[model samples]
Target: MWIAESVTFGGSALDRAAPLRGDAPALADLQARGRIVPLWQGKPLIANGALAWVAPGSPVLAEATAPVFLGLEDGIGWFAQDISAWVPPEAEAVQPGFLDPSLQHHPSLPADHTFTELRAVMAQLSPRHAELAATARALLGWHQSHGFCAACGAASTMVMAGWQRSCPVCGAQHYPRTDPVVIMLVTRGNRLLLGRGTGWPEGMYSCLAGFVEPGETIEAAVRREVFEETGVQVDAVRYLASQPWPFPASLMLGCLAEATSDTITLDPAELEDALWLSREDLVQVRTGLHPCVKPARQGAIAHFLIENWLADRLN
Candidate 1:
């Protein structure tokens, strides 16, 4: 739970500039001060002051760019040019290209200027330095994806300090969307139930999860998804932890469930297979010695939940 705050959207100490959300006068001041930076598709930071990711005159990668307002919600102003007309990410660009040293992306290109995605950059920066970066990255990403009106086909424009979008045609208003998905660590005494999808990397297995439907509750979604995918009945579902997955936007709700039955009748359509394994067996998978099963990646909530569960931290 301690790392929960460090998880996506949990609060990485980003300077959200919340005070400027509505104060028009202040937003204008920042625009004049030129403190704002551009975030590509709401992910990558381009430049601010002397700190820049894209080199001057480098083929303006239009495909990944979006103009975003950075500062408080009261009066944030847009500084970057609108580049939403561009298509998908450039094939040659690294995903989070800012992290690639070969490309020489910098979190603090200029000592006076700051950057976003601080959590990821924190490995090399102070917590305060990383916090501001995280704030900018998450907010910009939200604005980029929510550019279209969900209620109408009209194109929505950024408003409310980059927190709200207004449809041009029908007058519909939209906000950033955060979808909920339940990930369960099902336990039967000393053993844990882990599963693998058909297309997942070989040897990797993790918790079962699914989106919560409009009418169903979080706990019900966990139970229903588990039964539907692997025919394993679960009971005593308990909230454990949660994480934000910004790939398009989703909130992963981690939970613990007690398995009432051990036999796995996998719905092959949903998973390649599933089985109950003891802690000792899991250790092999974690260490890469298990012949058939591999553990989930380190940064994923699935891995975090499992590690904490194994350490009895969820209690």
Candidate 2:
């Protein structure tokens, strides 16, 4: 597990500067000198394959929400802001699909910079930018969806430099939430277990995964998820690596599990299809030679784990 943090969004080594979260004067100073990444409807602004950073007073942030302090790099503060309030002039450019390919441009921003889906450009960004973008997206999305306090049912205001929400009615406080999910590489002999979720892209398959329930351990979640989806009983489960998947907010716990049973009792409610593939078959799929199966998206933990397994680097 030494390579665990080498996964995308985990090894930035950015100093979060947590102590400054509660200091108004210190935060204000950082805000004045720090660069900000603006996100539109969850998509970060990218320019030439890198995160597009602008000054705190940039005109593009006219309708932006309060900035969230991401961290520090080389003694410079990094922040992210949500400009979801601004409407794109050409709404039609925004497509509706599993992954939106459309990009949005603001009149005040550089013509070369556009708001693009993080997934589409995640692999292209440097580790530091990728971590910053992921943190920003997750934090901003949390603020948007958790505006109301759970305890008092009252609207909450952003506090702690956007790391928390405070309710004025009941004085309740809430922090950003990250759900834990187990994505396992379940193998029996030389074959791997893969499942396709309903409505996923045709032929797309990935490691079986499920959310870790309350009071459940990661190992237990991996075993239960594989059994529930493919009727495969997992015997030995071991941690592999992890990724911060902020498509809303999820921390993907990647693991390798040895399967004790191979009989697939398809759970249609959980998967559209489930099957086993030998290491050789995975080689074909990886190289795009498989006739009916597509490998998981690159940069995802599933793909990373599978690649390492193929190269015999899992040890």
By lDDT, who's the top model here?
2
C-alpha lDDT score of every prediction, in listed order: 0.64, 0.91
Predicted structure with the largest TM-score when compared to the true one: 2
Q: Lowest-lDDT window of 10 residues in candidate 1? A: 98-107
TM-score of 2: 0.98
RMSD (Å) per prediction: 5.9, 1.0
Model 1, position 7, has a per-residue lDDT of 44
Deviation (Å) of 75 in candidate 1: 14
TM-score of each: 0.73, 0.98
**lDDT by residue for model 2 (213-299), tens:** 999999999988888888889999999999999989999999999999999998999999999999999999999999989977887
Which digits, one per residue and each the tens of the lDDT, describe model 1 over residues 1-315?
655555434454444566666667776566564544444434335233122333322344344343344443234333443233434334424344323321223332444332233324333433332333444555666765567778877678877666678888999888777789999999999999989887776677889988999999888998999999989898888887787665546788998999898888889889998888898888887888888887776666788888877777776
